[model samples]
Target: MRHDDDGLIAADALDRVTWAMRRAEWAAQAWKDQRLRPLGLAAAQYTLLINVHSDPGLTGAELARRLNVTPQAVASQVTRLEERGHLERRPHPRHRHVQELHLTDAGREILRDADAVIVEIERQIAEKLGPEKTSQLRALLDEVADAVRAP
Candidate 1:
């Protein structure tokens, strides 16, 4: 007797909420890909840059945990960013084996530009969703994420 918003009968696993979440993720990734193409950055790279900008001195292993990626993956991205002069790995203050990440001046400049692009994209999304609904949606998503992370 249950029907989705489209009037189609929904499967138990692929309900309206799940479908919406999946489509939203796909669309957002596609949009980010298009926007970042000219900047020569992928969504993952941009995410890494943003994370490092926000939390300076994070190690590759820490970034891996925060980004939900493998340490090897983080290392690879770190190498790429370092090669581009976007970031550098400095000696950790306490740990001899761990290297802390630091964004370069070039990285900061590029990150500022990337932030503008993301802000514009977010502005468009907010315009469509309206401020109230957009806030509600963000709060709901954060709550869901927190709940999932709860022990």
Candidate 2:
């Protein structure tokens, strides 16, 4: 049995899947190092902040679900953010045992700074891949995400 030199069978769907996974990992690390670390935020923390900003009253469990993480993990990150003065926990309107998450004024300001870093990273990627190709790549990735998330 001869192995393909490219380590992929011709026209194999798994080839694209494997490539996409590796590319995503590499891109995430690069973005984190080049864009997020300088902002004094880890990628997870940044993601949490963005989620809370977008959904200001989400509970810890809701955030975990949205982020595909465990509630404990979300709670830990939330605790850190609250300690940093970037987030606040308020009594849930209807749930006596749960609290809703909100971004503090500092959180909003930090998010704006993070957005600038993200925009700059996107701009750099666009320059490397060109606008048309970058847009196409994003659309293709979105399709992949939708397909993977379909139940």
- The whole-model lDDT of each prediction reads 0.90, 0.87
lDDT for 55 in candidate 1 is: 96
Clashing pairs in 1: none
Overall local distance difference test of candidate 2: 0.87
Cα RMSD (Å) per model? 5.1, 4.0
- Residue 77, candidate 1: C-alpha displacement in angstroms: 1.1
lDDT for 50 (candidate 1): 97
Candidate 2 stretches with Cα past 4 Å from truth are 1-16
Q: Residue 61 in candidate 2 has what lDDT?
A: 95
lDDT of 1 by residue, 1-151 (tens): 6445564544465667767888999999889879987987777888999999999999999999999999999999889989999999999999898899999998998788888888999999999999999999999999988987899
- lDDT of model 2 at position 37: 77
Model 2 over residues 1-151: C-alpha lDDT tens digits?
8666674647676568768788877886677666777777877888899999988999999999999999999999999899989999999989899999999999998888987887787788789999899999899889988998899
